[model samples]
Target: MNAVKIIAASPQEALEQVQAQVGPDAVILNVRKLPIDGMKKLWAKPQVEVLAAAPEQEPGEQESLRQLAVKVQQLEGELHARGVVPTETVPSPDAKLPPKVMQMIRAAQGDKLEEALLPAVQVLEQIGLLPSHARWLSAQSRNFLGATKPRNLPEEMELLREVLSEYWHQLARRLEKPGNPVRVLVGTPGSGKTTVLAKWATQETFLRQRPSRIWRLDADRPNTAEFLSLHGELLQVPVERVWDPDEQPPEDTLRLVDFPGVPADQP
Candidate 1:
């Protein structure tokens, strides 16, 4: 309960009016002089403000909190290594940073952290680190190295693996089942394609449980075809200068081709 007493031009008149009205034990919280308003005006007088005291903290409770703070500080020091450890030790300030905070700071700081940590991040992620952990470490490392974190890692390694798996599965599905060898040897001139093919054929025959007969296409000319035939005889494989639809290639045989460049106007 609260009370306010207003002083008038005559204190005795005000006291008499209050005594005749409310009892005298009523506490007075404010006392102010009202400015005179003209008799012609019926407007209210301006009021002065008086505020209450705020609640104070208990001394015992405050002491307990201080003690708790000291204990927490001691525990924190014990849990973490001290003496200005390198930035590398800490979790990524950038990667683990809340996204909204990162965005705001990046807008202010600009490509500041990305330059240093992006390469490391890509390397680590490629080796199968969890996404969040990879990003956090990358971001942190970048900030530690005094650079802005990259916006994205080059994830081509993982993407490439996925694409290769898909491609192999599609190829196998197209074949429908295991069959004889199919080989494509393509390279610039003097790339050792012939030597590589021979080595691979040897591997297939001995290690892969599949013996192969190799064929070299010789559609160029009679002289070239004769030379290839001589070479094929040395390698113990068949050589042909033309296609034969009715003849089956040797079991599990790989056919190799060398193509000449197209003429300017040829379709």
Candidate 2:
């Protein structure tokens, strides 16, 4: 494989350049927004950098590309060590993060965390927590750091995890149980609301031996009623299509209501 980096005014432009140079079969490895420098920061738009690899070539070419990649990595490391490149590329988190989460952060924020809070943020990322959740936990950890004596990275991580787990446990206990007998599933089109309803109905009818019925709201979309009817057959329950608000099922049975999905632009 032959890999090359392309920088352009926008991601779309960069993609065009890659397609033109390496053809459609090229694999995109990474995309990042580059930082602007000096006077260019004032008026020039930030550029997007795309790293792409051509499909497998000859054996000699593959070996050459591998060597080139290693050399490039070494050069980048040297630049970072010499302070020629910005520190944003280097995440100073003491712990390693999961590859998936690391990729997500890199794509979203260029793998950058505030330097002072890198350790805490890294611990959160390692546990596969969302960025918002990590930020909140990081803030609480910072408070603890200030109130107590300094600790090692591992100790700090353990303390923060304990604190966060306690908070979630307390939250789960405080949440009120659902009082309403009727349950409704809602989401955008093809969001798996119907499938979820089917699974729930199956659990009730087969596992718990509780009687359940499905009520689907009629809308512009097609095949919803048919789909629910199929699930109804499997569950040995009746599936009803309701257009009017006043339509009701038997009072004794568990009812699963399926509301039509609305587009974001619709009123």
Candidate 3:
């Protein structure tokens, strides 16, 4: 329920700032025309701006709006002094979790496992499972089987290991035949392309019998370069840099190219 103060030449300009920062749906809570001398001694005429609150009107929108509000509040004073306002929200801690998990956390229900949902989604997503599948996996993890006596530790560990092994084997089988690896693979932010690349490289190293060589065509980011470089060093694999596409790979070497998965804007 915080309010932001902004000074603009006109209400329209103030509304633009609100829309650009908080968006178009912001409710104009209050607006006032004020003398410039109140804060600054620079202008002869008065300035005006509309103050607005654009609370998220729907259950699904609350988290994002709350996050935006917090960020706007943090920068409000600085923005006022500098004559600018934030146009986007700071990233939220729960941003990577699925929307359903966010919704459940907002609900704050006794029956919901909101605390567990973030980690649950992360683990399942890392294991190459989709949201629908992960939802089922979370439910499975909650099984107590009526009243549970102290189970034999050894038997329980064995059962858990077997389940994990089968789960991964099924995941691995989903991959397209370890064919000639792609020239370049791209994915959006948070997509596990880099990890998948390392996993693929390690599999290739073991399967090829001969030492595997990695050639980096281009890294989408510094982090990607760091991960690949570290993995290559650990595996003692030779890595080459190819800045140009026309540059040829080493003779009889496996080449892996990583590209930034930039999504195309829709028309």
Candidate 4:
């Protein structure tokens, strides 16, 4: 699958360009208003940018396309670093990969890398990484080992920890800061939406010393309302069941709305 960004005078024009260039199977990823340029800001209207991605291809072709896309991205980065414009068209997915990239792909597919990294993979798996996540971590560990050899098991484990720590730090940094005055949690049944909301409320009230109000819109779940109320009482915060859609929370307080869990199939 391919992705591209297009800018036009309006959203409709941008979408028309996407459909023309990316084909009818392309899906719109995002649309945003682009900033008006210097002189254009005085008289011209702002442009709109649309990001779109092509539909998935067949399974056998999909893997090849993914690898090609990654190589293309790497090539683009190299070109950008050297202040050179990257070529417009990348090699087709069916085209043969370069020797070095082919070797890397082969090594990733082979059992030798997996065997060498099994201990680290096991360690990560034991620490709550899902099977897929463990495999991904193992692959990254293997790549790291290829570039720099570790002398012992302890060193290998340290490298694994470093990789995990870097990823954890990145994930934490990417988490949205609590900027919204009114936050809502909505998810499917048994999705732990209530638990997450309660935890956020706890952090706001006790950790940040900020007053918070909890509203339960899930009247169907009386038990959840009671659970939130119990915690509210302990936190000395007001918990209300939102019977009316237009009901507003108290002023100068962080408001958290707990929504009813909808069925996945329904939505």
C-alpha lDDT score of every prediction, in listed order: 0.45, 0.64, 0.53, 0.64
> lDDT tens string, model 1, 1-267?
434354444433443344344343322223333565677246664442221121233469557656655654454454344442223232255466788886786687664543333443445454576656655555445334323433422232223334446657889889774665446565544464554554455344334645455556532322222333433433345555555668776666665553332333454
lDDT of 3 by residue, 1-267 (tens): 566667777655665576577654444445566755455666465666555565646645456556644544444444456664223222245457788886766567545333242232333344476655555454444452432332433333233334566668889789756545545567675576755665566556544644566665554444345556655654467666655568655555567765555554522
Highest TM-score, which number?
2
Two-way lDDT contest, 1 vs 3, winner: 3
| Cα lDDT of model 4 by residue, 56-150, tens digit | 67567557556655654554455457675312222233435687786676677664333333454554454566665666677677766334666
Q: What is the lDDT of residue 233 in candidate 4?
A: 53
Per-candidate TM-score against the hidden true structure: 0.30, 0.39, 0.29, 0.38
Model 2, TM vs. native:
0.39
Ranking by TM-score: 2, 4, 1, 3
Off by over 4 Å in 4: 1-118, 123-131, 143-150, 181-203, 206-209, 217-222, 225-227, 234-236, 243-252, 257-267
Candidate 2, 231: how far from true, in Å?
A: 1.3
lDDT of 2 by residue, 59-114 (tens): 69557556655654555455456665222223435436777876776688764554
Candidate 3, pairs of clashing residues: none
The candidate, 2 or 3, that scores higher on TM-score is: 2
